[model samples]
Target: MSAFNLETCARSNILALEPYRCARDDYKDDGTNILLDANENAYGPSLTTAAASSASSATTSSGPEIDFLGLHRYPDPHQRGLKRLLCNLRNTHHHTDKKITPDNLFVGVGSDEAIDSLMRCFCVPGRDRILVCPPTYGMYSVSAQVNDVGLVKIPLLPAPSFALDVANIKQALSNEPNIKLAYLCSPGNPTGAPLAKEDIRQLLEHPTWNGVVIVDEAYIDFSPEGSSLAEWVAEWPNLAIMQTSSKGFGMAGIRLGSLFASAPIARLLNSMKSPYNITSPTSALAMYAFSPDGLAVMHANREKIVAQRERLIRELPKIKGIGRLRGGIESNFLLYELLNKVGQPDNVTALAVYERLAENRGVVVRFRGKEHGCLGCLRITVGTETEVTRFLESVGETLAEVNGHDIVVYSDEEKREVEANAVIS
Candidate 1:
């Protein structure tokens, strides 16, 4: 094991480092007589966010009736029920080599907290460094800066499908003696492709990353199955897998996130986390959703989202000026790389297109500028079918207005042919 400078790693930002010792006076808020202390709603979970019950099917052919509730209480510090449900989904017990129990899991405010915690627990400030591959998630770098840890970015080799450069990553780990974390955001954020399983396995086996390898499966549900490196947690004590209900589970508003790791890492995370992390209502509702029947709803939703995502991919390119749609439909989000005559290999100015999309199309999409390596790309989240239709309509309108060309919506066959030709060329 590389000698980690324990003291430095422990010194996070003031918010993380300060001990929580609230005075009785501090607990008293100066407000009106009818004051609600924390400003949380007297009611719990929003009506739109609630999962349909077993006895009652809301999304049936009859009509669309959304049922939601409001909250009133602290959430469970340890999200016991939701953890079990997720474990069941992953088939944690079915592992032949290693047995994973609930002890191996820890729930956080969100995976953002887990990322911050990993930096706090592992990366020694000043001396130690953590590595991130560019064209990946930005949180890793942001969290490192906040925690005062060093960040080494090795841009993912864009050729041969934007795969991680294992050699460069290993070299960074070897050269940086105190390197503590290697972040892999699979089916990555803007690029939208899953890291090959074999490439991930190599990183786990590599001696340099015996520190901590965080596999952020934020978009895994959208990708092809059996691609997660989650099962490797038991085999590699240094590994941590981050999952979130926000993206796939349609619970992003709940702010629920999970960390799956070996028992030892789980213990440390639990010890460091703030008490009462999850509110009581959140836990109760999540428990309700975790029930075998509620899970069916989630799976059904996933299937619907996947289907709609495929439909979007097939239909997107017929609009003029749109080039290759670079991301995979495995997740709910699709990142399309636009073909701009002005877009250079490494220098596609995405913000100009982004501005055009927002003002001309009335669709809000994330534009990665030069800093993130996406020169002419726009990331669009997959919403409902109606939402998608509206989005495509917007795309067509925007293209027509921007380029003075007639918008030609392609049929399924036409779109596929274009994609195939685009790929071949």
Candidate 2:
């Protein structure tokens, strides 16, 4: 047997694609750790603080004491306990008459694993495709490309401020007829708009389309009440909801993502995913995070973060070059454009300001300039009170320094034309 060329063995689609670069990849440590780039909870959801400080407390006072000495063993392959806890939480908060069970849930190492596994189960390479909306989560497309799954991108409604294009989606499904999965990011990445319930209901009711609708509600905790479609999965077999503890529960380090779907879909995903993928510690932390005290902490954190988000919405426009604050008032992040001296979407300035804030001042926000309907825009994660204040000061300084460059004025026609062909790269 001859030695195989790894490159030759690699899938054709993946060979040409660039790997998804996470927030830490872009800016490692800016000394201040004012990391607003990744939509992470700057304030963590740990319940151990009370036990850590009080010297008079009993040894068992700390809730859900994790077995650190059990590192030699593997995690629970079935993850029944975690699933049951999640089921109870959903039943309580989702306000649905129907009950969700452990059988209806599938756990993964972040929603990325769930997304990838679903593609593996549903899509056929080269023959089948997935429908995606532009300026949504990068991972959906990246995962599709890696899985050699085709993409039918339907741009979001422009005039309505980046709402889901339900009309075009139906049209795409009609034409393609091979789209197996539809990835809808509610509280959409880079565009904090929550998907309209009626619009999603229409998609679920699309008579001709037989594909599953995977609604990524990773940021739904920050969204309004009744915004999430997780509960609807019980009624609609084809609807799958991807939720995460990373954003609201502050369990990013634990790497636990959830998929709430019909029992069959959940089973299929569980069957296809790697055995023992989630570790013991991660499972323990997640289970504890959903416990009574932990849930209380999560709610407290949401209130404070939402307050800061409102403060930013009220104050960020006061900065000189920030043109228009886009996206709905939802999620832990905001997307707003950076303008030039003559009042144009200045991609150059946005990029420069992002770099300046990250490299020089230790403040980091994402430059979403090239995303659809997000021209000359930056996506900033809502941080704690002190972090938000520091961000305002540093970002204001950077914008002031970068605002005076010669700008290219685009005609409305040209703007429309260029923006129409929105590319993720």
* Top TM-score model: 2
Candidate 2 lDDT by residue in tens digits, 188-287: 8878888887788788787777678889999998887666777677877888899999998988998999999988677666666666778877987788
Off by over 4 Å in 1: 1-75, 92-97, 208-210, 341-350, 369-373, 407-417
Writing each residue's lDDT as its tens digit, candidate 1 over 151-177 gives 888888773267888888878777866
TM-score each candidate: 0.79, 0.79
**How accurate locally is residue 24 in candidate 1, as Cα lDDT from 0 to 100?**
22
All predictions: root-mean-square deviation over Cα?
A: 7.9, 13.3
